[model samples]
Target: MSSPTTPVRRRCTLVAPGSDERKIAKALESAADEVVLDLEDAVTSARKDEARALVCRTIRELRTGRSISVRVNGLGTEWARDDLRTVGALDGVGIVLPKVDTADDLITADRLLAELGSTARLQALVETPQGVRSIDEICSATGRLEAVVIGYADLGAALGRVGGYTAERWLHVQDRILIAARAAGIQAIDGPHLSILDDAGFRAAAQWTRDLGFDGKWVIHPGQIDATTEIFTPTSAAVEHARRVLDAMAEAETTGAGAAQLDGHMLDEAVAVAARRVLAQTGG
Candidate 1:
């Protein structure tokens, strides 16, 4: 298969530690496909209101910037009401409901969006024991639910599971979440790597997520974007190989051949489909 040279949006986004709202716009442009203005673990209880207010302000005032998402207060938080009501009012804001464990959470949020006349989409942070159990039902909750993000930090804590470096423990959880998201035709974003200073560790984690079939990952720093792009985007050689396979298949079709071969490997319908899809997506 031949590879293309054009650049596309990588499958990662960097989020500020809290909804600082100061450098978010620039951070989004700095190299991420999405920028989450966090109001959950990033914000302290004392500054929840401040974070929420800043997130809402950024949504409304900074409309001309890159993709902006919000990780809102959990279902148990005192600020959930105001947080939902405020951010739901903004147009094009992607809402990330944290620690979701039921369809009712999404239904309630969707109702709020309708009442507010907002067309925003919703993403679930399936981070609870019950959330993992109810994964299928949660995926079907609302038309607004467009993605599922695995919040490993809170999830492990909730499930009484100890943390690890390779995420081997969360493999089952991650696989199940991916299955649910794909069934719903939604994107699946993996959780972040906690080690902030280790670029190699972050890159390995990013590659791990990509290999797990996640469309993207939760990034915490600016340095991680290049790594994310490196993992998500197909290399020039890969793009070129896809192009060659596509062309060869086209030629085979013109000659009324049953199939084709690329690099002495038999090419079939499945391979053709994948190659064509990649080429079209990357504009090869």
Candidate 2:
């Protein structure tokens, strides 16, 4: 089993179909914080074998700065074992387990990876009703689990939610995912915004998720990368304010006070914690 470490920045996690070598090449050059070579929904059943071979080769040969992950087929499916066996042996690669509905799903995958003598991490893609409902357990399921991702399209379809993207429509599930991820101390990722041409809508969705404390978002198209990074990256003003909050609290601590005033608002240890988080997000 891979020892879990702090997840890399995933402000824009670009995914490419494993069957398409050209797309994979392009995604590697796109400079997204993370690149996912998808072998699950992105590949057709007939091409699963072909895609698997390509993904294995690509993962082995490629060299890039971004973190790499492979979205394996669901554990219930026939393809998942082969997918895990092939890629799980690749050291430092992240294994994205799609349609993960329970802690057992993760535990089973963990066992497989352990048997493979693999150093691969796990990312749970919670897309089904059961997955969302059992999210807390799933998040805390295994040490290999590094992140909890919302598979919005599949999740919405399973929940019978209709119409275009709306924050209100996913608020409850989103909040649940966030809370559970925080409890497990893992990264929370928002699913892809499928409307590739609707720049405005994409920006709005990224902003909403960023505000909700998602560490990053899945990006299906490279076009969405810039907006995603822009929205997720802390602003200069916000970083400055965070620094000020920390400075004020530190001064109060030196004076033997438990709190202080900053910009006419109370600043305490709790506020300093948030400030430090902001700086940490920006690597300040």
Candidate 3:
């Protein structure tokens, strides 16, 4: 297992088409914790080369302190090799590999990044059934694997489901991915909500995922960023409560007690661990 570390606070990752400079510029200016310049799904076959050039140039010129990850074309595609060779060489940019089915995919991407002398981390998207089944190996594939994002839409299609986000169909899949990510000490990011116009629906889904221990979520639009960020971030009251929990725990330790009562609730090591996580996420 990878050594545990304070998790990076990436509450919202906004996806922009690589071919759309206007959207990319707006994403850079937005409050997203990360911006993904997408070369797959968002770009057409005829424009793949153009999108790659735009993404490389944008990463080179942009000054956003937030993470800038480029989602390259999937493996086996004609453009995948060139995408990795070119965009992977740029400094200050991470690679988000889509349709990763095994550890070998991650290892190959890591090797390419190394050969190019880039220090960017990897974010693997587990979209297919094979990817989901081999998530554990993928998470442990390389030390440079920083995050695993579930591609819900593709996964759903692969599973023959359509149209709606059904919790019954995805709960186990999400949990399995989350467990693999946590075991490997990496981030587990929830996929985008396609109902961008349904604020309530998005909020409900975001809250559900957050409650299930997902570290962050993807934002398909700028309007979705604020809500996703708000949902993932610890509230001020929660942070204060976490602080008090730690203080009480410290007092208990000083008294040579293994546990203590915080307000009316019994507090112990598990609770302390959770409280610490809350504070760490909020930078409290």
Candidate 4:
């Protein structure tokens, strides 16, 4: 069995409105690797308590094999503490804290979960400039920290680039989140693409983030789940090449050689490590 710290294969995380049972049910049946029953942005202030109750009930009833996470309201909010206290004790349900600006936020949440006797993992949302700047500290804050999700919509608004993000405009911030999470040995997930109708644009964005080393992305709509999963998972050809690289390395090791030439390219320990990463991703 995988540990809580083990990086689960979360290629696509579908976000559903917590107050809407029908939508939440549909999301549970979707092809998403994970389903985030959202109680924050998806719920209005008037429906906050209702959404929390609905989300807790849905988590208790749903039996989807996919990972389930709840996007709770940020700290200092009227509903945040109750949200954690109520949903935090459920088995196999993780908490996603939005607008996490400091390490203390995660630390407090971690302690609260412990106090409630809940072992649910934590995923931090880096949405503001303060969150982005403090990502490294937040990621290293607690062992319950499983992933760091880049909230592009909020981040863009914070940075005054709300219309759309060009590669040159957002790459640095995106990479900063990626690097911070990776450095702390946690999953780094990219934010959602607001263009729900533009499949091509979505694919391009997913590919860009994948190349930047994000573990996965948030899917605001069910339509984006399949493509996101395909983009994040290792391709068959790449997996085959990775196996060959490992085989060649093993053969070279027997001969006391530190490196070898394979397919007209040099294969060394670094190449072997990358190949192993590919195999690991594929569960090979």
lDDT of every model, 2 decimals: 0.76, 0.87, 0.87, 0.85
Instruction: Give lDDT tens digits, candidate 3, residues 1-284.
Output: 45244445678899999999999999899988888999999999999999999988877787556678899999879999899999878876788999999999999988888888877778999999999999999999998888999998888888998868766568999999999998887889999987665378888888989999988899888999988988999988989999999999899889998778888899987788789878767766
**Can you tell me which runs of candidate 2 are displaced by over 4 Å?**
1-4, 244-269
How do all models score by TM-score? 0.82, 0.90, 0.90, 0.90
Total clashes, candidate 1? 13
Clashing pairs in 2: none
Instruction: State candidate 2's TM-score.
Output: 0.90
Q: Candidate 3 versus the native: TM-score?
A: 0.90
lDDT of 4 by residue, 1-284 (tens): 11246656677899999999999999999988789999999999999999998888877777656789999999989899999998887887889999999999998998999998998888998899999889889889988888899888888887888557565578888888887886787888988886775467789999999898888899888888888988988999999999999888888889988777789898987798678767766657
lDDT of 2 by residue, 226-251 (tens): 77877888899999999999888878
Per-residue lDDT tens digits for candidate 1, residues 61-168, read 656656777888876778887888888777666778998989998888888778888877788888889999999988888877777888877777877876466667
User: lDDT of model 4 at residue 104?
Assistant: 97
Model 1: residues >4 Å from true position, as ranges? Answer: 1-10, 23-26, 240-284
- Could you tell which candidate, 1 or 2, scores higher by TM-score? 2
What order do you get sorting by TM-score, best first?
2, 4, 3, 1
